[model samples]
Target: MILNARSSYSRLLLMVVLITVIVSGSSRAIVHAAVNVPDNIRVAFFINLGANKYQSLTSVATLQSTDGMNLIWRDPQFSLPAGNVAAGNSVRFAVDGYRALVLETADLNAAIAVLKKIQASSSAAFVTRLTKSGKPVYQVTEGTYSSAAGAKTALTKWTGSGVATGVQTLISARVAGPWAVETGPYSSAYEAEIAADQLGSAGLDSFVALKPREGALEYVLRVGQEQNESTLPALQEAVAAAGGLNVRIPAAGESYALIRHDMTLNGNANKPVDFYAIPAGSGAVLRADPAGAGGINLLERSKRTYRGSMEVSVLNQSLAVVNEVDYEQYLYSVVGTEIGAKWPLEAQKAQAVAARSYALSSGMGYNIAHVVDTTLSQAYFGIASENAMAIEGVNQTAGEVLTSQGKVINAVFSANAGGITADNATEIWEGDDSFLTAGAESPDDGPQKGLLDWYYVALSSGQAGYIRSDLLADSGQKHISGAKYLKATAEGIAVRSKPQVVASVEPIARIGSGTLVVELDKVPENTDYSWIEGPVTPEVLLASINKRAKPQITGPLRTLEVTKTGPSGRATEVKANGVTVDVGVSDNLRGALNGLKSTLFTIEETGRYSILNGQGDQVDSSGQIGSLKIIGGDGTASSVTDPNLYVMDGKGNLRAGTTAPAFNFLGKGYGHGLGMSQWGARGLAEQGYDYQYILKYYYKNVLIEKDA
Candidate 1:
């Protein structure tokens, strides 16, 4: 019995060891990777969508509320609720039966004059442009009244020379129409605008609306904005009187309702609603609620899905798209996108804590908004980045935030740390945070050997792609020196069908070592922790940097060198072509040298590479040239850029190319190299560390606790 028990114990111990090995190794899942409400604190992200993708005015937008949208009128004082837009989802309550008083005018300038008179008479006036019978028309409307009888009473007083004496206007009720002189249902605003321009050249005023089309978005361009014409017969009569191109008025169920700051979109799945809000007080918001659980807020443009309700409103005339949800719930997407959707749960948990602290503390968005949806405020890509692991990480670390001296710390982290993190926030940003101190993971002073998973490589033909780090045989040189030029073990090394990555990708090109190449960067699978980006001359570097400089580099920029460095060898100040770039902000120094990837790089003046001829003597350039072909993963080889020269002998015998890059920037550690290193956290997590341990390791003297 003792012998049998011993044998069983040994088997159990082996099983545990095997599980640990599997968990620590190659665990990346093969997945290719809200604000508003006073009762509960939330975050609002100003996402650039549709036409607002570039402009401040969001002329077109798609808003979906999960529980149907309701309209609420503020007290007559017109005090905009806390965040400029309306606060609290009106799903709770809405007082209905409000009628809008609209006055129609043929000329826009005349409408503007009439609108001024209405507002002067104690009514909030808004101007709207609409298309009636293929003709452009303008309307100036009063905000709203509790009853139609009340509206009519005001309309009579206004018509009796109270608003404007000789305006030549018609009084209209319910300003949206059931028909329009329409064009198309384009897939994107860009495409619709192109088509709209074609119609404009033929003398037609055009407008576009981003609306729902069969479960997706349709950028619909019409002859004019929808305006007040309640019936089809009335529209037909007006079109006949104007007489141009025959209007193809859509059939019934096609409805367009619009107001500058007030919108009413009842749950008519068939109708396309165009809702905008004129800033009555500060800004106006209109929320569209979805049908049910099956309803989607925004489908990440194409393939992504998110939880919670989507609030749509106009801020600065741009459609401000905000995803409103519980604060902890928002982190599901935040943690996933910030780190990895399929990374080990503990690593993502650390990310969740850091992201929460940073977002809550940095109020770097539109008013009442805590953060933006970019690296400018940490990646928050909504539902597309969320996964099972992300959900777990966020839920497991719910409300947990890192705080220092009773305030939430700005836990800024980057891709890699080289080996040790930066001394403090001063290395990257302006001020220094006591907790953002250096923390070393490994004993090495730099990137560990063989730790790199992917390499930014140029082919023998000088084309760019990535190769697995393991496939590269060492060129008998340390990476801390000049530049990394790897030698392949065999001829015809296969490149990935996917650029800048390897692992489970298909093989693309079969090029041999006869091609001289430059390995620009050595990054891990999930972090741009190490990179190299130049050969740019002082003049070229000066041109790229001067565009962003205030005390710009003026004279002939001939000399460039780092004058001062931080604790992590990150450049704090630099002499750019003899000009001292000692600005108050350290980040400017990072952008000085051709906008380098990071400041922790050594400048290497290259172009002295020696090539061997058949006679065993080395020369600067090769005497004979070899055949070369460039292959692309895009399946179109002709699309890639190339030079008109070749010199390598096409086999690995040290034959240099005709021309080599001039100044190679050999660098390590991406980002500002401050605070926690994301890849370093990932490595520690894989080594069986918990979230709390990882957080304390990178951050100095910080307490991990629930904020509320």
Candidate 2:
């Protein structure tokens, strides 16, 4: 039994060693390279469905990767959202983890052969040649394989090449594997990925791959996976990122090699290519193979055709050691003060780009080194050089003092200089100078002729006067055809009707300032006062007026008398001063009075007239009445002393008891009370008050901060 147990233990130990080796090998494979596939990959394609505009469709093509082969095709029957599918339009498709390939044909046999050819090529050689329509086709670089049978098995699952039999064939080719191609020698993988993503967005599948020649990994972008079709456009955009073009592709059946020939030697042997980095300040400088060597062989690697270049102006550079507080303050001062009103839109955009670039590159930790693009010539006043330095990351805010024209000026608070207000006569002015005045009498001696200080002059009816420039109260001034009136009290009041009692009432003239009045006649003694009709009362009635006196009425008054016909019926006989008067049944007494109250009646017998209440009970009466006072025949009191108010026509003939429509005074402007309008802020700014002062006066308990 002991021998058997030992044998079993030895077998268990062997199993453990095998498991350990497998786990270690698996981990190492994963660590060999970092996958450069983006989490979110976007792709688009150009397709032609048919010739007729009515049936043609440019739809998004679907893509997928199985094993080492990538399949790409369009579903013509696929229905997309309405208005999304258009003829001759490009369609965009996006997917994560896998790259996109445009297959030239749906034929499985042709694609398998192409994959085999690519797999056989060297690592540096990514492009493969294919024959389409009996013509040799050169395409984007792809992978190579050892045998044609192996390639066929891997690509057998794909639905044959989708290319048509006759037309020039073109399609995307996607391959699986970490294929690496040199895209300039980048120091960081992050930079390589950035370039790769840019190329991928342009419909080129690329990634960071190891280059054994350099002993350092560089970004290698592949156009197609198994098949090589035209990818020159995508490669052009990617090369432009590094300001390179004139790229060369291998010819059909050519091995992986970059040939450099010295044209100066006529037929000299091809030499190895060299690469160099150009300093940022040198504009359009040619890159050299060695650090500082200049030789004619550098031109040997040049490919024919002009490649477009991307120019990024280094307007400003900042040191990487600045703190957040100083950086923010510096930015604030630059935007709020230096470039406040004088900087144009282009300069502002440049400044913003510079700031963002510095923040991103330096990680908000390092001091910046600034370099200005002096080629741009635009005048920016009030912008300090120190502020520019701060933006470029050269100096911190606290350590630098901004000098305007070499002299430091303390921050000054601005005030409201241009505005309109009641204090200044209504007028319009240009920059605190009286341009025009409006409303009221001309200034011979009445008031100031020109605009008030910090006020505008607006002329209504061509009248000139001064108004607070900051208080452009009037959007526009309007005039009433009739004369204007001034009140006696500073606290202006509106009255319905003019009142008698000369010593108690103050008379106001049209468009005139309030004038003090003195009484010259003895006040009349009466319990009631009379109502005057007009916009203003006579000056004689305002003399010695009691400032607080109110209007009252007194006189011999004749009242309308009525007698009831039944317990609940209308009145039968209505008389004024012992004469029969007309009485009409109406909903409102005011309406009935306006319609029939003023009919003149000839008084056959003079007697006191009493006005009965709605219940037919006597309320009041005239103590004594004369024959001429009561003179209406239609039961209306025309000339009765103290007759009820009624309407009259243009002929001055009384219209008995006719109701007149109520009057409405149409008002202008918004808000309660009349003073200090808010819409006038811009006018105030133009007049002279700074924006801060305007806000301060308009809003209470507010503080302005640089950051805010």
Candidate 3:
């Protein structure tokens, strides 16, 4: 008996070891060399789909969702086979509502491959549908229990998957229209069956079906027959866990791979392949043109042709087009659009390196793509706008990326720094970086406008303006007046009256700096180097401030003051009526009131102030104006030369006087003034500074290395 027990124990130990090896090996299979290399980054050219103009999708290749749960085909001459997803038909779910895990991708072929891997790894049924916003997502039902408790229990089992998991209480049957996840139109049924078997082995259940291909018989592998939407991220995690298969849901509508093949242009055929997506519909749609004979308009702002694929999906009730292009190719368009193709070679090279580093570190496209095609990421227009100079810059700095302690750095840059570089923490959100430092600008001739003249004029109706230190007559005493008065009474200080009498006069309307213009020294050659915006009205300021915040503010905006300045004289804290309302990154201050050219400025108001008497009236030289007032001059009345001269108050009230209330923004520089300045780099290059010197000067203690 003892001998038999010992033999059984040895067998059990052997079984345990085998199981451990298989589990560990399966985990490692998910990541292959191709996906691991960081060689190329995916960019979502289109994300917002509400504005999509596509009426339907037409493609020659069969399309499917990422889960291989459904199939869509469009051929004018042929009918769809049984079990295939019919165009214009909505996918139905098992229960009134079901939760699912989804994965999004711009490539249909890749989605199918990923779906097969997911099927092999997990024992869950998946469905495909365009999100309400138009993104085609693959979903797996964690559980279709009668109660939410059952769903929660199933979700708990996915803790090790690391996917975005959630429990959705489906209120009704999800009517996700027919979407497809398909695999090849094999030459024969036997071949298709073999492929299906492989997929089944991988854990994906699929079937073989006959389909038309180029006027011949063909068989295709298809899956995704259910239509229940669950926590969509679960499937993505499952695929990732199974074997690191890359599959993503397409934008809502129909996910398609847009291909622009060889075309005759100017009597010669040129091949520049590109891809796009469209919504799913009927009538030869799957086998038709991407835009249905009408070419889709993409990246309309720069009017450039994109040589990459796009995923069109609906997001937030709007249509978004995401462009997925290679990292180096994207840099071609960005370098040119950002610094201009006409810039110096060295400057362009520096910019190329900086842009590349910024793109990888920004993490803006972590969820969908690597980066956007707008200024939100970097200015990327695609291949159509590629210029020779920009191309040269990218080639020269190929595979170069900025690194700090073996990690990529977030290389940020701007237009002009007004002669001073900003500290990273001060200019942007508070963060310490060894690279960006506060110091004098590199270029000796870097955007210097000198000390410009500023002034403050006073007006009649209690409006006030700024009087320059040079223009001030004397450090005079301050006085209060008008219907509202402050006095030290026996019972503390009393303002206005005990019953709180409402003043008949409205509060002084502080005008924005945009209203007044100050003639100042500036870079005459380039106008954008210096700019002016508002004497913006209070209403406008309020509206703009409210848009960036919540709990909407109420305002007749009384005042705007720069409460703090950075080492470079950049506005760090701005106060609106003694409240610290302006707080955020660099853009907040510039965009606060009708847009200020830069934060290096001082506000000047012009107006006359006086002390108020006990009767709540202006106390003039003689007495209270309402009680016994007499207008008088110092010894002799001063005479004005200009007859058109009118004095205005802080409230915009005007009357005959020597001066009027006006404001001035005496500031310098353009852009956020952080990191490397484009013009500054050019100036440095002109001064014989190489690209390395320029980069080192702007970003201190940084190492330049090839990421390739």
Candidate 4:
């Protein structure tokens, strides 16, 4: 029968409700609040910074009141000295420096000490004072102010008015009821009724009553009896179940109803109709004829039409069953009768044969029947079976064929033409004689078929026949290869210019350590270094040559000069004897020059030089010719005079009293020391370190794994 959209929706809803009841054994319940907060306190602000750099400041600081007004700065400049400030110190900046300094205490004592310290310091140029009536009032004592303007005016006026005292006031507010709940009171009966209706619609019951308080009549809307005692638990459950649901509850004996002017159903304004159920397990059948006298006129109304459709409600034993009469069949039969043709003959014969076979298969002990639409050529045969062989065979056949063709067939029997295909064929082996064949069509023509021409016959449980072949396309299976690790030596030894870029000749991976890597289609060439091609794999190798070479240090040569002095007696007479020799001198000069080797020294060539003994007395002088000695004298002998130059060791250690160029490579750490050190890694590895352990040591506590 043809059903309208509204009827169909109602039927679906009925089915859903029936299924829910059968599965869960209970209907869903709505939740309402039991208690709510009363006082409306304006939230100044909400700070949610956790235990971070700002948490301590917010927790320790307190808002202060001065002149009967509470004052709290949104961004007060306050700090405690880094070393002195403990975890929870209430601190504020006085005229002291910008650096955080600890407060002596949380009260006026600390505030006074900080103020006095600021006043004594010469660097503090700003004056601290209280304010009264928008004017500065200096205070002989120190305290927190209620407001910026008040503090300034009080301080200024105090200086002129000679007020040396201030009072501190603190405000504490208490919260009542559920801190986060919102509630309202209802005064009108109409409003309460509306609220009740809303709550009832939400599956929650609400009541309305008069709350007599101090002889005054007050209407109260309360959650209905079903939820009064269990409101809190139910509310919590509902919130946990479906995120959040609005809830409300009234005081004892005071009924409360929900406010529902803005209520909606499943988020939609329009409400959906409720669905009713018609019994299906048992039903009576329509007989072919009715007796004349006591019998009712069954045929006349039995085949009655309802808006081009018909419905039959039957009682079978204790069960009531309802079935739709195929209107299409009735129309077809009427047309056939008018034309005087045999249009219904085929369906009638098929049903009769099915009924007889069903009865025989059931051992003739139980009743069997056939419900048929002759004109539409469709029929349903029901039977009581001992073994159910026929039903089982039909179910098995249909399941196998449909599953093999990847077609989904519903459990119930129904006639559908769209799912039939030429490659998927079906034939009835027992109970009925029928075969289905899907008509062939070109790809461009699409499918050209009719429901009447495609027949399905059920024999056993879930088994049926259908047109076969060409129903499903063939799909190929895929084969996957196993993972493999590849090994290869570095073509040449060189150091990478950068970590990834090969520079000059440098050592690559160790000689015997086999670096497992994935194989690639191509190798990078003439590009400093080649990547592993793919992910590095694990493989054992006896040895691997370094891929990069170390860089050679090449530059201009540096020159260093050396000088020696002659014996004190010989050098002193050079000018007097008029001797000018640039070659070898005496044993003392040779000894001093040998000692000066490997040491840097400054040489001063004075026309005349006086040699002093350890006692600081001049012993001899080189006159006219010249006198020279190593800048820093030999360790055992003193110099002829004070020297300007000093020598330095390879480690840049300065030699006493010598002028020499410092060593070129005298820095801390080892290697180039600019980036990660391979030597360091080797050192760690030699000390029994894993790859991840090595990486963590060098890169701080960072993790290393496959590059996901």
Candidate 4 displacement at residue 335 in angstroms: 16
Once superposed on the true structure, which residue ranges of model 2 sit more than 4 Å away at CA? 1-167, 172-338, 341-708
lDDT tens string, model 1, 1-708? 456888999989999999989996745221111211122224444433346332322223444444444332222233222121222222211111132445666676676667667767653455555444445456665534434555566566666655656767654434332134644566565676566555544444455543333444345654532333344454444433444234455553342222222222234322223334322123334444344443334422332445555555544323455555667767877887877665678888888888877776674444545566667677766666778998898888767777777677888887677766776555667676788766465222224444547765666554555677666766755333345567776677777523234557666566665443556555554325555564465568767667767688774454466777777777777776457765557766556666666777776443334545447787542121222234457654432124322333335322222233345566777676677778778787878988887888888888776734
**What tens-digit string does per-residue lDDT give for candidate 3 at 1-708?**
456887989988999999998988653111111111155666654343233332211111112222222223434565342233233222221221223333333333343444444445453334332222223223333333333444444445443353332323222222222233456656665676565555544444344544455654455544332243343355445433433223343233322222111111112212211111222221222221122211122423233455443443333322344455567877888997888677789898899988988898876543445676666677776555678988898898777777777677888887778778877677656679777756756462444334332233332333333222222222232223211111111221111111112357232333332232121111122223543332345567767777764444566455556788888878787666557764366557677655766676665432113435457776432111123222346544333333123333456443322132223344566777778888889898878877777887888777777754
What are the models' TM-scores?
A: 0.54, 0.18, 0.49, 0.13
lDDT per residue, candidate 4, 1-708, as tens digits? Answer: 999999999999999999988877542111122212111111101112233311111111111111111111111132111111112211122110011111112233334433445345322212122222333222222222222343344345434442223423111111101101112245576665555545444433234433333434344444422212444555434423332224343333231111112111222322211111111122212111111111111112222211111122111211111122222222232222211122123222222222222212222111221122221122221111111223322222211111101221111111111111111111111111112122211011011211111111111121212211111111232112221223323432222211223335343332112323221112122110111110111110000001110121121111112322211111211111222212222212212222211111133321223445457787333331223343344455433343222233345332222121111101112111111123333334445544333333322222221101
RMSD of 1: 17.1
**Evaluation by lDDT, superior candidate among 2 and 3:** 3
For each candidate, C-alpha RMSD in Å?
17.1, 35.0, 23.5, 42.3
What does candidate 2's lDDT look like per residue over 281-399, in tens digits?
A: 21211111111111111011121111111011111110011011223333433333323333333333223322322222222121121211111111111112324433433222112
- Candidate 3 vs 4: which has more TM-score: 3
Order the candidate numbers by lDDT, best to worst.
1, 3, 2, 4
Candidate 4: RMSD over Cα atoms? 42.3
Model 4: per-residue Cα lDDT at residue 270: 29
Report lDDT (CA) for all predictions.
0.55, 0.25, 0.48, 0.23
Model 3 residue 377 CA deviation in Å = 1.1
Between candidates 1 and 4, the one scoring higher on lDDT is 1
Best by TM-score: 1
